[model samples]
Target: MRIGELARRCNVSTRALRYYEEQQLLTPGRHPNGYRDYPESAVETVRRIRTLLDAGFNADTIRIVLPCLNGDDVDMCPQVAAAIRDTLHGIDEQLRDLETKRGRITALLAGRQL
Candidate 1:
């Protein structure tokens, strides 16, 4: 298969596939003509990548855990668990910061003291 076929099967754009390759997430071989030659298993690899990205896992974390993924199941070793916990903690911190900003804005709108 080629890049186009892999992108179609994965329902993602060729640019996205290229970006994935650039991110070192997907590795496809090349033909003598300089065209990318993707393996048949690339389809499943793309699927897993998309699933992890949609779940808010960063490319760095996904790279670490990609090999641990088998279909929808994850090995969830200590590293994976720690990665997940770190992501969750980051999200929580962002939410708390947003809440504080919202409270400050609301107080300003209500003309109340902080």
Candidate 2:
């Protein structure tokens, strides 16, 4: 398959595929005429890449974690574990702040003295 075909199969744009290659996320072989020649597996690879990106993983984290992904076993990579822990910690802090704001709003709605 070529870049366009790979993009279509993966539901991504050709530009995105090129960007993935530039990020060293996917590596397609060059054709004799200098066009890209993507293996059939490129479709799945692109999907995995997009999934990681959607999960708040950056390119560097994805590069470190993708190779360790197998059958949903991402924790096998220590980097993946660390990244997930950090993301979770950030979420926890955000939740605490939001809860504090909610309490303030509730108190104001009840006409409570602050």
Candidate 3:
């Protein structure tokens, strides 16, 4: 299928698909007319990319983790495990900061001055 069809099927914009290509997250073949030709599996790949992005993973992290998500034996790589662990740690720190902000807001709403 072409890029438009893939975008329609994936419910994402063509710009997003192009961005994915630029990020090296998606690889579509090129037609003689200079159009992108995507395989059927591109739909599922896009879905997965959306899911990861929704979960706060950046394109680079997603690139690193895609092979693992695709059921490869990446667990054997200690560096991959470390990178994932670091990402999780960062997420936990962000959650803690958000919780602190929420508590301050709650206190302010409760007639307490910050």
Candidate 4:
């Protein structure tokens, strides 16, 4: 299908699709007119990509896990395992940082009079 159809099916903007392409997350073919022609699988692929994005996984991590995404149970290869472990570690650090920041913000708010 065309870019517009793929975008509509995924409920994502054309620009997002372009960004996905740039991120190497989605690959579309080009028509003779130079317009993008995405395969039907692109719809599901975009959805999977979006799901990973929503989960706070970066594009790079998504790319790493792409192969395992199709399966219900992730039996990761060493490479995929490392990628996921690294992502989890990163998220842990981020959560700790956010918790600290939240505490500081809350203290500041509490010490101030409206």
Task: Write down the TM-score of every candidate.
Answer: 0.86, 0.75, 0.88, 0.88
Error of 2 at 86 (Å): 2.6
Ten contiguous residues minimizing lDDT sum, candidate 4: 67-76
Better candidate number, 1 or 4, judged by TM-score: 4
In candidate 3, stretches whose alpha carbon ends up further than 4 angstroms from where it belongs are: 71-76
For 21-107, candidate 3 gives per-residue lDDT tens digits of 999999999999998899998888899889878877788888887667753334437766776787889899999999999999999
Reference-based lDDT, residue 108, model 2: 92
Best by TM-score: 4
Report the alpha-carbon TM-score of model 3 versus the true structure: 0.88
The order by descending TM-score is: 4, 3, 1, 2
lDDT of 2 by residue, 34-108 (tens): 999999888778889999899777787778878887756665666678876776787789899999999999999
The lDDT values for all models are: 0.91, 0.85, 0.86, 0.88
Candidate 4 lDDT at 13 equals: 98
lDDT of 4 by residue, 60-109 (tens): 99888986875556658898899988888999999999998888888888
Task: Give the number of the best model, judged by lDDT.
Answer: 1
- lDDT over C-alpha atoms for residue 20 of model 2: 92
Candidate 4: the clashing residue pairs are: none
